[model samples]
Target: MSTVLQPGPARRKAARIAVLSGIASVAVALAGCGDSGTPDASQPTPEASAGPSAAAAELVVQDPWVKAADDGMTAVFGVLVNDTTADVTITSVTTDISPVELHEMAMSDGAMVMREKDGGIVVPAGGSHTLEPGGDHIMLMDIARPVQPGDEIALTLTFADGATSEFTAVAKPFAGAEESYDPSTEMDHG
Candidate 1:
């Protein structure tokens, strides 16, 4: 019988390295198996992307009415309701009737006065925000024409995310909402 030859130490070491390299190559190939360089259909499209905070919630104005005024300043009152679970902010308001400003009543110099609201009005998630007299309201200054009773005013509200919503507010007769920037004893309780 022929004598059997044993593997040298260097040859054994090279064999081990070769085996390990083969295993590593297989692992790398398996890792890249499923991805075909194609997009998955399960992923959301660009239009309907992300969570609630990614989109602005549309606000519904319920019982919207503007205080009837002839020429000068007046106010718009309503209950801004948000049906979505996301909270929204009314940053600014625009109308053809007059210049609009978001205002609130605050105590200044030991008296109650109307001032520009710091920050915008926030409508909570699945909740409501009131734009009423003597509290928080949209002030219409220097009206273009006389707003008599039964007139409808068109307004567009700009949200915090630059989204806009258009709504029509009916004019109603009201004797309240007389508070000014100066100190006034009269307060609008409406």
Candidate 2:
């Protein structure tokens, strides 16, 4: 006797159920692979980027110093650091000196020459400028009083952006003709 294994209704229903179950399983697996919309405490948060902020204007004076016992004149030197992104122009400079002038040193005919400057120094964006001896420096002419060591002179620097920065340039004896002065010198000016 030959038995015919033909597909029955029960077998067809089972096959459909198996196919549906397989599809449902695949869909659930795919959904699980995505984010669960929950925060993870184990991971660290990212830090904010470092850059200049709006409404933030700052000037940092480094190694600021003034010559002691002025020989009718004195000079101040420092590094002006503008942390703002905008261009900073020194519009005006004021000190105790009678005639304060901005001077620039240049080499002419193999000789160093100093000339009176019209405008103050310009601090560019994300940059710094130095006002040191043998370079662009501040000339304190006709010094009214002797600026000895440990004396602090108030210097008001006005900017083009309607901002004013006040710095205290400490007075100290010139270390040498080439060596720079220490901004934190505590010598007794008395």
Candidate 3:
């Protein structure tokens, strides 16, 4: 004989409420915590070394980082701010971590699908494009080395106008990403 355990209406309501409350808590935390703080002495991130390029005076990069990955693929998250009159295209990204490409994630058929992005990412004039988890992001294909917490990864970004800016992204452990994306991957912003 088998037993049928059915949840009562009250029990179901309680479960739903619990789930919603948890979600709300996380939303609040992510919103309130702000950008990943500056890198520690064990590792230094881009925020430590440089400012916006002289050529792209109006272009700014902020809160750049990659999730910790020992190997395989990973992703980078950050914000591109463009206050200039000309739209700047991120033509290419180079890093010691791995070969990188512009990628986008979208919902397809009730599941998340990721694909290579064409034409690169554009920081619109007077606006910005954000690269975050579960959205448009930088894919570091096949992380060639051990990228662990308290490590720094060098990144170089080249723009459409033949301008380039170097970045240093700190490898930090992140939670809650496995719920929306592969745990092996990566974050972003305004």
Per-candidate alpha-carbon RMSD to the true structure: 15.1, 17.1, 22.8
Which one wins on lDDT?
Answer: 1
Q: Could you tell me the TM-score of candidate 2?
A: 0.59
For residues 138-171, could you state the per-residue lDDT of candidate 2 as single tens digits?
A: 7776779878899898887766656677788988
Worst 10 residues of 3 by lDDT: 181-190
Choose 1 or 3, whichever is better by lDDT: 1
Tens digits of lDDT, candidate 1, 1-190: 9998899999999999999999999998887667666665786554454334343445799999998877778889899998776788888999997998888888776767677786888888889989887789888867899899999999998888787888999999886544442223343321
Query: lDDT of candidate 1 vs native?
Result: 0.80
Best-performing candidate as measured by TM-score: 1
List model 3 lDDT by residue over 3-73, tens digit each: 99999999999999999999999998887656556544665455532333432545677888888877777
The parts of candidate 3 lying over 4 Å away from their true place are: 1-58, 179-190
Cα deviation in Å at residue 11, candidate 2? Answer: 88
Clashing pairs in 1: none
The runs of at least 3 residues in candidate 1 whose Cα sits more than 4 Å from the true structure, single-residue gaps closed, are 1-57, 177-190
What lDDT is obtained when candidate 2 is compared to the true structure? 0.69
Q: Per model, how many backbone clashes are there?
A: 0, 0, 0
Q: After superposition, how far is residue 98 of candidate 2 from its true place, in Å?
A: 2.8
lDDT agreement of model 3 with the native: 0.74
Instruction: TM-score winner between 1 and 2, please give it.
Output: 1
